[model samples]
Structures are given as C-alpha cells and as structure tokens.
Target: MATLSPEMPKSDDRKSSKDVVAKLNYVGEMHDRAVYDIRNPAGSNIVWDTRDVTIHDVRPHLDKFTMDTQGFAFVKLPSKFAENPELFEGNRKARHFVTDDSLDVQYAQEICDYIQNMTGARDVFPRLGGLVMRTSTRASAEKAAWAPPAEFVHLDFAPQAMQGWIDKTLAAKPRDLKPYSRVQLFQAWRCISPGPQDNTLAICDGDTVSSDDKVIVDSMTGDPSIPGNRWDSRMCHYSPDHRWYYMPDMEPDDLVLFKGYDSDVPDAMNAMHSAFQNPLGQTGVPRKSIEARILAFYD
Candidate 1:
C-alpha cells in the first residue's frame, strides 16, 4: 500500500477512531447451530435468519487501506442518469430491469465500457443491473424498489456460482465466444440519492484478507422455477489483518468500482464489502443507490 497520509488526512467531519455497529455472519463453528430460513421469498427478500451471529463495533481504519493497493477504486463520473432522479420509482421489486432503448440502460453501458477500458479486457458483458433504494420511512420504503443495507461482509459470488453464471450466460448467447484464459467480475455502484448517507458501504482491503477468513454460503433467490439451486456467496469473520475503509459523504456523481471475482488473481479475487452505519451521519436521509455487475473476459 502507498502512503495514505500524503494523499489525504482524517478530518473532524470524518473521524478516524469512530466506530459503528456492523452485523456480520457467524464463524464456522456457529454455522452448525445457525438457522437458515427464507423470510419473504415471495417478496424477493431471502436471508439467513440465524440466531448465532456477530454484531461488532468496527472502526474503519482507512489510513492503511486504499483502492490502488486493495481490490477497489473510486471513479468520478458526472453521469446523465443522476439528472433524472425519478427514473427509478414506485416499484415493489428490489430491482427494475433496464431496457435497451432506455436512457438509463445507455448510461449503464457507459459504465460497462469504463470498466473494460480500466481492466484492458477484450469484451465486457453486462447483466440486468438496476436501481436499489433504501429508506428509513415505512410508507416510501414499502412502495420503492428497496433493499436493506447488507449487514454481512460478503462477496457476491463463490467459485461454483461464478462458473455456473458464466456457463449459463455464454450458453444463452448465439455466438461462440473467443478463447479466453481469464475472466473477471466487477461491480459498479453509485448512490443516486440527494445527500449524505447514514448507512454507507465499508470495503476490506483484498491484500490483507486471507484464504481461511472466508466461508461460502448459499444465496437463495426464492425463484423455484429454476432447475437446481441458489447462488453461492461468501461470508467472513473478523481478522486482525483485515483493513477496512469507507468513502465519507458519497454523492450522486461519485461512483465506486470494486472487484466481485477475478479468476487470474487467487489471493485477492473478491473484495469484501458491506454497508455499515455511519456514526456521524445526517438525520432523515436514507441511502438510495444503483449497482451494476459486469463480467470481463481476458485472452
């Protein structure tokens, strides 16, 4: 990691020692006793209702970890999608699919191209990534396409799940893909809401995370029509070496690019992240964001 001090220093507004409660998944031994249940499967809200869990007051030691050294980076994009905030509204589902002709879809494709350029990948394939809104208010929250801030520190894909997704996605496409030795998965996330967030994301530096720190868990999407099974994801335990950081007061224009999975790099494939409560956050405003997952192919 390069020297984080010369770049920027902690301020009174963004304190260094500040700690917030972060709910994380249980360690391996406790998993045997943990409960696994789908709460609102019909409503697309499925999670582990495990009683055995760890809720820790974690302090984001940002001075140590950063994007260049870690598996995450920040991008400044004064996007066209931010202009019309009402584009995503009044949807019961968690995500609304973007059409090919829609302006939102066009903006999303721009992000895909940005990732491809950054990674120097031959081709980038985009999934149906859409709007995700979160609010503290009951009425507005109920009507909107909402997802609670992910409490657990986890990666979106495990080995098997990623391979399955690749196989399934490629099989559906009409043309045969060119031979590629490496595949990388990335997520481009941006907060489309107006102000500062109370529940913000915290990312762990990939270099510090060890192999034994991760535990794979099944992500049940609640769609029973599909043949065999749910997606596989990873959950993590607290490690002394784990270095965490967060971008304070993120706005509509700011974008965060992070790694979900990378086949070429084994030691630091998935960048572990979760939304943590900000102790110094403003009142009333909730977090509303959009995230797109893209697959990058390298020959």
Candidate 2:
C-alpha cells in the first residue's frame, strides 16, 4: 500500500524528497513498538508505503525470539538510499554502539518494582551493542587477513563504544585495510538499553515514504532471480539520538528493541584513525617506541 513514484532511470535519482524523510523517520521511530506494546501489539507499521506494515504480522516473529518474562522486537524498513541495499559485501569493519534510548525503554516493566508497574529497560537489558563489519566481494575472503605493521595493535572497546571507537582503530590501521568500511556486520548478540535521558527520543531510517508513492513496493520487472530486490524495504540502517546499552542477546516480547546504527565516521573515530599511520611506526618500530612517539606528540 506504499506510495510509488514515476520511476527514475537510474539509482541516483530514484528517491524523492519525501522518500528521504520517510527513510529517516523509519530508522528513528519504528522500532519503539516493542516497548509501547510489550504486553500488546503495535497500532501500525509504516512499510507498504501506506503504513500497511503492521505489528500484528510481526507478532509471530516476536513470539519466536522472546525470552522468559521478556522479549525483543525489530522493524525492518526499506533502505534510505537506493544506490545499494546490501551492506554485507567487502572487507568490513564492524562494532556496536548504544548511543541513545527511547522513552518506552525507560518506563517499561523491566526496571523497578518501585518505578511504576512497567519494567525498566535498564534492568531487562543493559549495555547492549551490535556486532557490525563491512563486507567485500566474495573474492576478498582469500586475502591473507589484512594486518598492520608490528607497531600497531588491535583492541576491542567497551561494547557500547565499538562503532565510535572503530574510527579510531581504523585510522590507526594500515592503509591496506581501509576497505573495511564497506562491509556491514550482523549482530544478534545480547544486551540492554541504558536508562532514558534528556535525549531519549530515537531516530529512524526508511526507504520510502507512505505519502510519496502508493506503489512503492511494486516492481515493473518482477525479477524473481534477484534475491533481495523484489521486496520494498530500504536497505540502509540507522538509529536515533537516544543512547543504548550494549549487551548479549535476549528473548521475545521483552521491551528491549533494536534498530540499525547510523553508518558514518565520527570525530572521535577519525582521531583514532589518525594515530594508526603516524610517521613514528614502521617495520622495525617497537610497539613501545611508537607509543612513545604518539604520546610525545599528543603531550
């Protein structure tokens, strides 16, 4: 039931202005229903371009993933950008981040016996982060895993900061491994959301807008050969301004929900990347030697 557009000849011109906003709203807001209806069902789903995507249909998926006294929900929308929907192919760098929280996650039944009857998101899930990695063509897996010179080292950040910290790690990584940005990693690990804060509202990314084109999901070709193409959902992933906690995986109907992370390098991420290739490190450079150089420069 989605709105469709006069088709564009190529991928670049495919989306209209409303398409962009719809994609954004989807990534930001759609995933909150798990908390809103922890004990019930979502009123509507924005997919099908007409908001035809409904929570009632998703209930079965929730029933499958829910755990004892808790569960999780996921809303998959179309990609915001049409250039490419698959983020899984390439030499990828992936990590997890819990940037913000949604209001429902805060007041839900998982938290406190004292704080209303709803469960607190923090108690049900805490420090949840996603596992993400860029992808490469089927061919790249054979490359001897890209490695940095002896001077650099690899370290995992606290789960919540993995995505943010990845920028730091990459800048420090060798130029040979730069392609890691393209691959998108899949994270089904467990975790919970941090409590709600001033920025509790979440953001979303969607492929098409309900108001834009009524026929958004329809295809002229009807190419059954195209594996992921026939569907109307957008391929991109992103979340809102709310902060979240990175944790391992949990069960269904639990108020904890999930959405995709915004894929971009932040400032903290860039700084980390900068340190990777500083002049101080080379083939024979001792780890301590390079660390000393970086320390001196920063000091």
lDDT of 1: 0.60
Q: What are the per-residue Cα lDDT tens digits for candidate 2 across 1-299?
A: 11111210122221322111111122223433211111122532333112111111122222232111111223221222111212221111222222235322232112222111121221212222222221111232222112212111111121243343344433443233323332111112111212211011111111211212111111111233533112221211221221112111112112223222222311111010001121211222121100100000000
- lDDT per residue for candidate 1 within 1-299, as digits (tens), equals 23323323333334454444444433444434222223344543224322222222222443344544577765566677654646555222544555657656666677777777666778887653354554433333324445556656778777776777777555544346688898878787776655556667777778878878776666654453562236777776667676666666676766777888877764363488876556556463666666767888888
Off by over 4 Å in 1: 1-28, 31-69, 90-97, 128-143, 171-176, 227-229, 266-269, 282-284
The per-residue C-alpha lDDT of model 1 at residue 13 equals: 36
Residue pairs in clash, model 1:
none
Weakest 10 consecutive residues, lDDT, candidate 1? 50-59
Candidate 1, after superposition: displacement of residue 255 in Å?
Answer: 1.1
Clash totals, every prediction? 0, 82
- Candidate 2, superposed: residue stretches over 4 Å from native: 1-57, 61-166, 172-181, 185-299
